[model samples]
Target: MYRFIMSLMLVLPVSVFSALNYLQEDITNDTTWTIQDSPVYIYGNITVKNGATLTIMSGVEVYFMLVEGDGGFREGSELYIADGKLIAEGTQLLPVIFTSGGDIRSDGDWGCIAVEDDSVVNLNHCVIEYAKAGLIFWNLSSMSEMASSVNYCRIYHSSEVGILFYNSSPTINFNSIKNNRYGIQTQGLSSPTVNYNDICSNYSYNFRNLSGLNQDATSNWWGTTNINEIEANIYDYYDNHNYGVVDYTPFLESSYFNEGGIGDKSLGWLRSIFVP
Candidate 1:
């Protein structure tokens, strides 16, 4: 009977058991992560270099190993895209998820998806959480043609800044940024359009402008309608002269989130984004 069972195991289909796609090495060539290969695990730092493209289809859940350290990508896992293109587009129903491994979750569990250099980035309808920093755009080469955009996304639970733009100007809109140390921080000549977002309930300031350039941060819901309470959460020229002013007038009094958990611009119709 034992010998017959051993032979039967060899004949059975591989789908009888679990299937996992483990990634440890760097992605040098163009790669595509599909929904069939759901739950793609990354052990360490994965860099998408120049001329390469990494596409993650909808409903593809990505887990990064979280090794606590110096708040950098030393032992912790990270997805660094520099001089490459990353198109991670998820739908309103099933969005892409980037979270830490294991069941329990916390902030700074992993590093982040660092979009730098002359890379082409499109992070639409995605959910990113439990990171030291959700998205960091640093010194991107192009100002217009190569400008990166993030839309209809929810970024939260970051120990540091949710979105940090340094010397790079990226388009950020229609996102729910909450429960972070700093919701958004811009520095070093960064000129980003921060509009139509639910920038609420951050630990520190919601928007911090370190650069001298003025920022247009209008039409965002800062969790409250009280004018004094709203400006209290913003860090800019009023606090320090060197820093630029964050014009957050014409703010949304209350969130217009629909039943689908999306804040629609047109009465909150609900659109695409990541995570559950």
Candidate 2:
């Protein structure tokens, strides 16, 4: 009898372990996503309404579903914050993961984490990948006191831009931004404090400033320290006099690449062997 009961337990479906599957919904009140209910699936857009807070605990895996066709903006899943707050704090050993649900995943597989309208967001020790844009701050007024910060995160494999700012200033530091079309892009008077990051090997320009506003991006490792090589990888005022300049002077002497880190682990064991 004991052996039969043990055998039945082994044959149980994997869904038995899953806690909650959140479909398309609006978070109107304060909510906490805990680690116990891990591997949460977001089937549709998750909009955090005004004055609400969504707290994500450590080691939580948030998977966004893939939408078909070019109308990803209208159909794909995303985390949208408008006049709300998002606090996602994770530890080094067990960081949070935001990834796609499709089996054949690539860049732009899903939408992005978009923050707008005086929303406050803080992401630490997280891994965000396979999206149009990993993080985007848009339409924030100059007088707004609410600020966003992304630190110690791995944002990669984006089809469009890893981090984009549209008339918003966010503090971005100590992150690994790589393997995307554009590592970071700013427009419309957006001046972000971008420093201490490993921004490298993007398909196009590593950094681009289109608003004609000078950006202070110092002390970063651009895969190489050669001034000429780094300048060639960036599209700024140097490329066009009308555009803003990315001050990449005094670059880091050594590469701050951390192996076996957040996003590195998600790249799969076989792929990481050749693609790092």
Candidate 3:
């Protein structure tokens, strides 16, 4: 698998001056809010609230300490993105950290770090690991129309899938998704533009799609070193490092390696942040 094989702690950057002031002033329950440490049995939904931006600092460990005491695994955490947004914009040098609390902690320990369907999710330069999946986008129609831009991130070592996209059209680029049951799982017409990623070494296939939209994975480092002809549709480019079935030789001659994926702004149906 394409696992990092080491546990790393990245230092995050401080919020910008204006953004910091805005966060301190607009955010509610800033002090009373609990920094999730132990497996706290959350029975209700947790919302960040409008005008309240929760800035998860980098290298700050968040442990989903859910326990399966006596009986089977108990019902754990469920973070409701009722409103507001989560800005986990970590840097390449200082990436944000989200992991289980204990040494032997399993994946999906807590509920998940969910971005409400109606809200905007901007995950830049973050390292999401050791959860059921790095991120989850659910109920696209209910949440805000803003699309998610997951860039320069590394997601690995999860129990289930890597990134799950339900009814959202997020742009995933410059990411390294490896060492998971499934790398990227797209279901129910969730059109995600995935490209320029090193998607390799997963237990199963790198990308899985069911909605049958224009989901593209191109110019990526697909766990192989062999250099040969390039193919796009219906070809396992990872194992062969080229066209496993289809013939992309004409495009390769012109140096056309990408699938020309459309960005979030061009989607014309969803709302999203800057196009990176």
Candidate 4:
């Protein structure tokens, strides 16, 4: 009886392992997911077909592993939600992360996360950083064109613009956007409710208004020198939130340090508040 019990235990373990492998293989062979040429790269530029709910699972690290010499990325490697809703709903602990497989220390690496007009992108608890830009919304024709809202996300270390709302009116609330060229750009008639965000010293304007009618409301912290321009809702040369001055640290060292030891105190506030 003892010999038979030991044999059963060994057989059960093998069977369970085999079952798990089979399940994994079945998922790998799923026709829904199309693996691109680069194993780590995936494209979302193509129009999201109707009746298909594309869900990217947690702990899945999708990187834009396109190098400069390797013909570069084919226009849209990041995300281009032209029509359908791209739901990247991640939890606080298991936030869906999108990163560029470039040197983390280097500047200007990958592209942006552009969700076009009229499309619903429910992105929560995601870390979209170290790319070209964080979120690029293009609906500049009018204020009503703005449609997306990013909540509880950390958008940092982007190449150019952090969160660029070109012509779209997006309610950018409760996000930590830092260390980029332009922190948050609102051009044309995109009058988003910019409140409760830690938009600190990017390269150029922290929050710029190209169209004179753009309304940059209140309750948010703009850590640029041109705080008056964004605060008073005025347009001027000095109002340009130029140069990284959130804490005088990123300008010296390429590395970005959160408000902890020797950085500016305001940056800590910017990193804390959530507009939502």
lDDT of each: 0.78, 0.78, 0.52, 0.52
How accurate locally is residue 100 in candidate 4, as Cα lDDT from 0 to 100? Answer: 67
Model 4 is weakest, by summed lDDT over 10 consecutive residues, at: 21-30
Off by over 4 Å in 1: 1-19, 68-75, 140-146, 256-276
Mind sharing the TM-score for model 4?
0.62
Candidate RMSDs in Å, in order, are 9.1, 10.1, 12.1, 12.4
lDDT of 1 by residue, 162-195 (tens): 9998887788988899999999998887888888
Per-residue lDDT of model 2, residues 99-207, tens digit only: 8877767888888898885788999999999988998888746533137899999999988899988888889999999999999998886888888899889999899
Using all chains and alpha carbons, the TM-scores for the candidates as numbered come to 0.83, 0.83, 0.62, 0.62
lDDT of 4 by residue, 1-276 (tens): 223433554767544533222111111111222222112243233334343444554444555533343222223345556555566666777777777654343444556666666665666777787777778777634534345677777788877777766567777776667777777766655666665566665666555555434254344445543433333322222244332112121111111223322223354346224211
Candidate 3: C-alpha RMSD after superposition: 12.1
Q: Write the per-residue lDDT of candidate 3 for residues 1-276, one digit (tens) a residue.
A: 001111211232334323212111223433222223211222223456765666665444444444343121223443444466676666767666655555566655544556656666677776666666667776557222346688888888766777877777778877878887778776665666776776667776666655444445545655543233112212232224322221111111111124333222122122112211
> Which parts of model 3 are misplaced by more than 4 Å?
1-46, 68-75, 140-146, 225-276
For candidate 1, the per-residue lDDT at 61 reads: 91
| Per-residue lDDT of 126 in model 2 | 95
